[model samples]
Target: MRPQDSPTRETKRLDGRWHFLADPAGAGRAERWFATPLQARDGVEEMPVPASYNDLTTRPDLRDHIGEVWYQREVRIPRGWAGERILLRLESATHRATVWVGETELGSHEGGYLPFDVDLTDHARAGELVRVSVAVDNRLTWQSIPPGVVEDTDAGPRQRYWHDFFNYAGLHRSVWLHSLPQTRIEDITVLPDLDGDTGLVDYAVEHSGQGSVSVQVLDASGAVVASDDGAAGVIRIAGVHPWEVGEGYQYTLRVTLSSDGEVADVYDQRFGVRTVAIEGAQILLNGEPVYLTGFGMHEDHVARGKGYDDASWKLDFELLDWIGANSLRTSHYPYAEDVMDYADAHGILVIDEAPAVGLNMAIGGGIFGGQGYTTFSPDTANEATRANHAQVLTELYQRDKNRPSVIVWSIANEPESDTDASYDYFAPLFAHMRSLDSRRPVGYVNVMLSPYGKDKLAGLCDLYMLNRYYGWYVDSGDLDNAMLHLRDELGQWAQDGKPILMTEYGADTLAGLHSLDGATWSEEYQQDLLEATHAVFDEVEEFVGEHIWNFADFQTTKGIMRVDGNKKGVFTRDRRPKAAAHRVRERWTRIRGRA
Candidate 1:
């Protein structure tokens, strides 16, 4: 029974338990891990799906360790899904994987945090079982890992990053076996008409073998307000509604694919009809001047680590809500889809990015291990590497394009930008993203405040975001001094005539676990900094809104003069609130007149 509606439509996931395997690096080489007839036989170690692997590891370390994680699971098709087309999907696999249906090949997918799905109507025997195998890439991004402790090397050389935070591997998000139709809504391009307040919905079809498609638009009450014949790319919804953050109005854009009037596929996505543009040096949300207030987040917590479960996501969202955050930066990379969905539903704007953090920028101020960053200039390179980077962007767009919460698509985090030659290589990569979704903006956090690359491609991005650690890194810095440095940095972008975003800023503190007496780790020190930061933040409304250095204390292998990853989260690594957290929350409350 193929889907009478849309077959390729993806389902929204809430919760489920997933089985995972704990093995060493390269344990699953060439499908050998789960190749055995009995091995693909399902029901291994049942770790919770949609959970991180770090929580289950015995090492309980943040960095400098060797281990591999192999994940396998049994998927039960819901009885209700018996008659429809079903499939198995993963929001991300840490490294690589080969999926199988009882020894028969379905497909293989790689790249962490990228979503991929496989057809199951034919391979799956209605109520039968299926197995998913994955081999992750924890070793390569070891240095790139946030911060943690490791005591073994049954694996390879430990990879470490100079920055702060831990990198937990495994199926850190969710695993799902969904039901779909033969032909369904594969993708959509909502080119809302802003000129006359009309809506244009352009959608694509996913069919098995070959078939025709029918599309329609339904209002909140389930009436066919607009309909189109054939597979026309555009359908107009007259009298469109607008969506703004505080206003909270939304619509469900539905596309139905049909074969000879029999429904083949159906896709329903919730989106707000709105436009985001740059007015000089500012971001206009829904045609209104807006400010971005939030914190940077890494996917690590104290004891639980990457194995953090769905409950952890709830905790994170609760904490964010309490802190008055309207936005979140998936620091250095993209995060679990559900996390972004929560933001979308809850009204938190997102900056979805690729996992292209470059360590070529004078690593730890020591050997500059990862300084050249993305292009692999004199570093990691091969045609495969460049292709991998491009794949990441494509995967990101495909997985999250329907999300109204995602406002921007960043190509690389902070690539070294002090030279023209670097920009020459970086330019084409930036252009590639524009090619995919010309609807959103693309950007990167700058290496440092420099005139060399200020707004070099203003058309490429709507806002110029700068990531700086000035007061903490360069000056002993009073807030005023930091302001001067910030102003100096902004001068170039101002000349370039681009809106600015103070993208990353804030001093790290251990939240509730602060050590008094030692001013370096004291709560007072962090509070004073936040106080100063807010004071200056209020004054710099003309630049761009600010998101603090971090939302929670995360892992980092760049254990420099301190412990793993900077312990600067407003809350402790375990989600405990710090003194500074309260201060910042209170300040925001005051700003909103809710204190």
Candidate 2:
């Protein structure tokens, strides 16, 4: 079944050319760029609105830009939309964003991986051209999630981060000016479950103005199946067709807000009826245990550089399908809503992750060897950063909670979970995530840390998601030694009596390189390492899944260790497969229906 677009009342696409200016000195606020028309300003240049400024030019300086950049554009609100509640919606902004409509300051939002909106109802009159200015800052500091340092160099203050990826900053997603009724539905939440033979849908809706609400649940044929009149209630169908893996079935939910028998607003949402549970060291999907076999992917490419592209989107799914993959973890952050929609329709499982990468306290260390033995402390685990981390998790959950494709939520990527501060910081955060959606399992991706007393927060996770690079990082090129260490570690973790997923394990090999001796950086070496890793995984019944480190190569912060970029990808950056791809396909295909 093809996925349908989200229903909306009225919308005007706000993409295309916009005036841009780099503000390295943070002079935008001082100069009051938000208070005046940007066209009158001198140093403004034309730039595409829904793109990263770093890759739009060939200049190396622009590609490595740090600090704030202003983007201003002229928009005309529809004349007929005067009585409607106008909203200026930005799909995503990098790091931090402040929006101004005309001279009125709408407000600011922190964090960049989620959407933000500004109500432009009182700021602009309909049928008039309004100046909209947005200030985006991509700088990172110790006080920020994914903490870093700003060093003053001879040229200027250089922005640096603890994360591996390049800071591709700007408005990296689409923007829109949409309209809705004043007495509109604020939010709609749907939690689907199986109640014996009946399909149960529990929902809660929030609205702004006083109005009587009627909710209707429609099946695939667009016929109303169940309904109720109120703000929140459950609607159950007599016999519900369950959404299964590799086979998708979805239902439409329409909520209408009305006063005096006239409909004031309508919100249309789509969801699937399914249940995800953990049954004694096994992950059960729709009451059947599933073995996850796929890769941890990134929203990355060569030219786009994290900017969303339709062609890449289509190609990605095609390749995944070709390689016989059933699932993938949205490795480091929540992906675009459309990506989730695609997965929901295609029946691909997802492990939604938060943008809490680089939370580890060890800033600089040896590339392969462990960092100079540091632990999480109050300096890196302060209240402000933790609060931001919590907020990002909330936004991520709220934005993607409806998608049935997402079976698990990964809170952080590679945080320092082996310390007392880590336990203190993640205890409340993990509780919050589980509270938001109890239907799905929640966990964090643990790095190369000892679970024997060192990993204090292992109990907090429903599943242990380990990212181990034994042959690649620890033992260098010796798979026998790597497998020996892996077996001992797995044996230790199995004592906890919980399911585990090798969330990341792969050797970085440049495409087309071959060596019969199986040396590092060769395709044969990568395949051999994966074969050894799988052998250990096969021996342990507690091991449920394994997602190779990366689906493809992606750009990273400049480092001597990287050859242009990280080459751990089973497929090259261009989506072409290496020798490991054929091996993975054969393995996944053989165990497709083991349950």
Strongest candidate by TM-score? 2
lDDT of 2 at 280: 82
Superposed by TM-score, candidate 1 places the C-alpha of residue 362 at a distance from the truth, in angstroms, of: 1.5
**Model 2 regions more than 4 Å off:** 1-8, 36-43, 363-378, 593-595
Give per-residue CA lDDT, model 2, range 1-595, as digits (tens): 1111233368888888898988866788888988887767777788886677887787787788788899998899999788888888887788889999877789899887788888899988889899999999888766566566677899877875666677778887788888887787888898999988798999888888889989998988999999988898888977897777777688888888897678888878889999999888999988889998888998887766777777898898988877777899987877877788889988899999988887775533215334433335555447788888889888888888888899999999878887777898889999999889888999998888555457988889899899898898889898999999999898888888889999999988999888989989999999999999999999998999989988998888788888888899988999999999988888887878431
**Superposition error at 517 for model 1 (Å):** 9.9
Model 1: what TM-score? 0.84
In the order shown, what is each candidate's alpha-carbon RMSD? Answer: 4.7, 2.6
How well is each residue in 307-422 modelled by candidate 1, as lDDT tens digits? 43568889998887788777878877778766866776666788887876653354442222443344334344333455677777887887777677778777766654554554
- What TM-score does prediction 2 earn? 0.95
